[model samples]
Target: MPAVQEVEVVVAHRERATLRVGDMFLKIDADPERADVEVQAMAIAPVPTPEVIWRKPHVLALAALPGRALGRLGEPSAASSTAWAAAGAAVRTLHDAPLPPWPGRSLEELAARLDGECEWLVTNGVLPVDLVTRNRHVAEAALRPWKPVFTHGDLQITHVFVDGDEVTGVLDWSEACRGDGLFDLATLTLGHEEHLGDVVAGYGADVDLDVIRAWWSLRSLLAIRWLVQHGFDPSSPGCEVDVLRARM
Candidate 1:
C-alpha cells in the first residue's frame, strides 16, 4: 500500500476538529456521545450521507460525498435555483421518513432557551434593546405546537452537498432528531432568503412562511452569543447579525 497521507485540518476548535486526507474525512469531537449520535443518525437517515469508514473513540472517519457544499452561510450561493430545489426535495424526504428514536427539543424547551438567550443578549449589551424585543416577538411565532418529524437539526446550507442540480449528501448529523420540519427549512434558508421560493416549490407542499421567518429570528438570536464566544464574527455582512438587523 502507498504511504499513509498527511491529513489537512479542515476545521479545528476546542470542541471538535475535522481533517481531510485524500477521499476520507475525519471528525474528532470532544464528546464521544456526539460521535455516536452522528453515526446512528447517518445509519438511519433516508437521504444520502457520507459513508462511515471507521470509528475510534472520539474520532470518526467517513468517505466524502461526491460534490461540493451547496453554499456557505453569510454569502450569496452560486448554486442554481434547481440545486436549491433539489435540496428542498431531499429535506422533504428526510422529514417524511419515520421519526428517529430520540426526541429533539420541544417547543417549550426551545422557547425557554430563546428567552434565556434574549436576556443574555440584552444583559450583555450585545444588541440594542429594541432590536432584541422586536425579534423576540417575531420569534414567538415558532413556539407553537408542531408535529414532530425527523429533522437535520443543523441543516445549514454549508452542510448540504450538491452535484449537477442534485443533492448528493447532507452532513453533520449529530443534532438529528424528531423536530419541526419547518425548522429545517428555516435553517437551510437562514441568510439566503431569496432562495425560499425555490425551496418551497420543491418541497411540494404549502409552508407557513411566517413560522419560517420566526425560526430565522429565533435561531439567529440563540446563536449570536455562542458564535461570539467562539471567536467568530457574527456581525460580518450577511452573517447572523446581519440577519437580525434585516428584521428591523
Candidate 2:
C-alpha cells in the first residue's frame, strides 16, 4: 500500500488548502474550483468569505486559489491590460469589503518586526554589516497618517489569479492588516509600471497613486535589505534582486 502523504495543497499564492491526500487527487495548475465565496460573489454582487467545508483539530479554515497569475501570462497588450483591470476591480472589492477591525498590529509594527528580525540576525552574526540599509528608514518614513483600510501586505501579480480577462481569485490573506491600502497597491506596482497604470486606470477613483509608488519603493528596499542580510551574493543569483533595487 502506498503510504498516504499528508499535505497542505498549495492551491494558490501564499495559501494552502489542507486535505487528506488519499481522499482527493491533486495536480499542479489544476483549477479545482472557484473558492465557494468566489462562486457566490460572482453570482451576487458582494461576496462573503468562504466557509470552511472541513476542519481539523485546532485548524480554523482553508481555501484554494483558482486561475493563473497575471505574470505567468506572457506579453503585455490590450488583453493583458484588461486582465490587469479585472484584477484591480477584484482588489477594490476586497478593499471595500467591511471586515471587523484587524486589531493587532500596524504596518509600522510589521516593519519594526522585520527590523527586529534583521537586527537579531545581524547581532547574532548571521547577517552582513550592510544588512541594515537605508531601506528600513524609507519604509519607516512611508508609514504615515492615512485611513487604515485592509491591506494585503504582499500584493503582486503572483498573488492574483485570473481567468481569461477576469479575476477569479485574490490569493493570500496571511499578511492582511488594517493599514494604508496604498501600501498593498504599491507592493503590486513596484516593478511593473505599465501593469500598475492599468490597475490605476481601472481603479478610476480619487486614490493617491503616488502614495502607492512610495510604499512600493520602500517595500522594495526592505526586500533587498532582507535578501542582502540573508547572504545571497549580489554577483550570483542575487544580481536580479540588485537590479530590482537599482530600478527602485
lDDT of 1 by residue, 68-141 (tens): 99899878899999999999999999999999998899778898899899999999999999999999998999
Total backbone clashes of candidate 1, pairs 3 or more residues apart or in separate chains: 0
Each candidate: how many clashes?
0, 0
Question: 247 in model 1: Cα distance from truth in Å?
Answer: 1.0
> Residue 198 in model 1: shift from native, Å?
0.8
Top-lDDT structure, candidate number: 1
Clashing residue pairs found in predicted model 2: none
The C-alpha RMSD in Å for every predicted model, in order, reads 1.5, 7.4
Assess candidate 1 and give its lDDT.
0.92
